[model samples]
Target: MATLAHLSDLHLGSSASAARTLEEAVAALADTELIVVTGDLTENGRTAELAAFDRITAPLADRLVVVPGNHDRCGDDVGAQLMRGVRVDVQVRGGCSIVRIDSTAPHNRVPWLSHGRMCQQVLEQVDVALGAVPDSVMTVVALHHHVVPLPAEGFWEQVSEVLHLPNHSELALGTELLKVLRSRCDLVLHGHRHVPRQFIVDGDSARPLRVFNAGSTTELGAFRTFDFAGGRLLGDPRWHQVTPEPRPSPQVWQAPVCALQLA
Candidate 1:
């Protein structure tokens, strides 16, 4: 079976001390057919931080898939460099066609915008991109924003308050995008919460879709290794969290058995 790697929230300049973790992650994912990065490439989207990450991921450039997080958009370019390198929506190797959708809010001046919004045009573009996929291939939809509110409260809330972190989701969550996505795709991946989670969304289609957030790859040293064949994921999802210590975090989340569980 072919393996796909998912990583997110590098927060490069912010998490620069995790240099060893970055090195290990890149080394670990070197063998995967595709590596999906769900944004937060830098602390504030600085050129140097991007360069740091680019240098770290240079080995996997040919197979890399990425989307910009709010932090990455803080720079003047609005993570334009990240999008520039992603030339195709579908993989030439086929089997899996991953379409990247930008969920970041608009910010022309000083890149002040945060949170997420899909907009009608973005949804239309997402539709057009999916049209390029073949029916036989499995589809993976990726974006920087979480369509639904994730559990980020309690102590985390206080911490965020202290850190001055803004609202995690967009002022207007484009649930319409989720409704549209639920009908067609097999898997949807996103990461902005800086927390790793696996969830099931019941779409109009009989087959429920899987959603995953890999957390902060560089800072938290979190990442996922997926076993898939013919564009469909196989068995349970096996995710790993690399810690600074000798011990690492390994977690498994199985596909839900009951449809109501999703509801």
Candidate 2:
């Protein structure tokens, strides 16, 4: 089985503490086959900050798969340039097909607007990418935003929406994106909210879709690994952390059996 590490929200330039935690986390993953960073690489998308990220993650450069987050797009177009004009990335490693999606919202001068969105064009691109993968391979999709609303998001986001503030918490068109993914993929991984979460999106298909959010790998000093083979996950995800204390189990949410149409 292939071992894959999932990490997110490094926020490298934010503080010295976070950077140190990131280093420790990376060290623990020395044997992981692939390290997927969902996003938030830097506190601000400055050239220096990006450089710091590159330097810190250089040891695992060959096995890294990264996508930009809202924090990574705060300043200029550097993050976009790093993406190389590719919104969807498909790669096969260790018998698993991983498709990464760029879910960050379009650039705006307002830095506090941290919500994500997937337009129709990007959704179509996801379809094309997944179609190219064979049925025999386990398919995993990674992005920077959570597609379904988590319990941790409800209270604050509802307040933001009621106040008509610009800081919306939910991903626009997320439901549509979830529907598209549940039909085509076996697993989905993401991060944005700093809380780790897991959910099962069940449909009529034989295999239900599993989704996991990695939270803030730097701040939380934690990451998760999965074992996969023959297009299926072998067992429950295992959490690794820099601290000695055991990581808390993530809250589980289950999608409706018929169809997932969450509002």
Winning model by TM-score = 2
TM-score of each: 0.81, 0.87
Q: In model 1, which range of ten residues has the least summed lDDT?
A: 252-261
Report the C-alpha displacement of residue 107, candidate 1, in angstroms: 3.3
Q: State the lDDT of candidate 2 residue by residue for 1-263, as single tens digits.
A: 77889999888788997788878877887888888899888888788888888888888888888888888888764457556788887977767788888887565224667778678988889888888987777888989888866544556666877887645655666777777777578888898887777777774457778878888887666788988877787877887778554333333222222334433
Give lDDT tens digits, candidate 1, residues 11-64: 787744656677788887767788888887777778888888889989998888
Error of 1 at 262 (Å): 9.3
Error of 1 at 67 (Å): 0.9
lDDT computed for candidate 2: 0.77
Q: What is candidate 2's TM-score against the reference?
A: 0.87
Once superposed on the true structure, which residue ranges of model 2 sit more than 4 Å away at CA? 151-159, 203-205, 244-263
